[model samples]
Target: MSGRQEQINLDTLEPQQLAQVKKQLDEELEHLTNSFAQLHAAQNKFKDCLRCVKSRSGAPEDIGTGFLVEKKLKSAEKFYESKVEELGNNLKDLEVIVQRKQTNARTIEEVLRQKILASQGQDQQQA
Candidate 1:
């Protein structure tokens, strides 16, 4: 990428235009940062998940001890998987929230335009 930046026309933008742009940039940055964090976190989680297989690969424990360790390791794997699934669900919820906000914003924009036109009509009628 070229190390160049173009001047923005923020000065000429209506208040609504500026606000919408800011909202979009904020959402995009949030998603980008979250995804990057999740990527690194998942790498670490995979490393931790190896414990599921490692418990069986090492020197054999006593038969009685082996059952306990296997049980514990299986529990740990379940816990880890559940945590990852919870995070995935949380991300989905966030997506739903952002979608709701977009819908609400559009609704507000329409209402504002209607109000503005109504006020303009009243002004003309009075004139």
Candidate 2:
């Protein structure tokens, strides 16, 4: 059935065919779950490496230039952090606006549907 249009309706499938499909789905799910676990482990290891590198970079007092460098790095980090926070707040505001707009759209659609049904009923009565 490769590259061919074949539609198999589950409601009309044979018992054996349904069982085969279920087995294939189960195997695929297992493979995907295992892959996700491996990826999660790799991510954790990467985070650990980052922490280790930061720890090994030495204290600011150990070197004269290190203090100045550390201070500048910290200032930059704070600036980035504040920017991220501001962006996050903006994103939340946008989400609220989107939700309100969606609600309004649904309400409008329902009202239109009711009016159409009422008009159809009146037409039927007149006929």
Candidate 3:
């Protein structure tokens, strides 16, 4: 009854039960074969449809070339837009880093200036 096929002990089954099980298995096999044939026919029909679509020639509008091109252009536009957005974010991050470095450089310059002034004062006093 479940997805798994349970092993039946043929020796334990009565003669009537064994005959009924065999008949049921035969019916199941027939049904499966019929279903497989139907699926194969349907697949062949789809292949025929693909062949027709590929071989038919008409105006670009009639054959959907315009729709396909528009779809492709939209996809490319979205890709480039995303790339531009990513680049913008990267530029903002770089700007922040540059600002931080500039601040650090100014702080170091002020410290050096203070040291120079102190040394000059000490030298003047010694002279």
Question: How should the candidates be ordered by TM-score, best one leading?
Answer: 2, 3, 1
Estimate candidate 2's alpha-carbon lDDT, on a 0 to 1 scale.
0.53
Best by TM-score: 2
Question: Which lDDT tens digits does candidate 3 get at residues 1-127?
Answer: 1256566555455545555665665565455555545545554554555454445555434235437544544455565555545545554554554454455445444554565676689999999
- Candidate 2 lDDT by residue in tens digits, 1-127: 0136455555455445555655654565455455545545554554555454445544455355535555655665565555545545554554554454455445444554565676689999999
Per-residue lDDT of model 1, residues 1-127, tens digit only: 1236455455455556756766775676577557756755784576577565555645434566446555666677777777767766666665565565466556545555665676689999999
**Weakest 10 consecutive residues, lDDT, candidate 2?**
1-10
- Count backbone clashes in candidate 2: 0
- Model 1 CA deviation exceeding 4 Å by range: 1-57, 60-71
Score every model by TM-score.
0.43, 0.49, 0.48
Off by over 4 Å in 3: 1-67
Query: On a 0 to 100 scale, what is the lDDT of residue 7 in model 3?
Result: 65
Prediction 3 TM-score vs. true: 0.48
Best by lDDT: 1
lDDT of each: 0.61, 0.53, 0.53
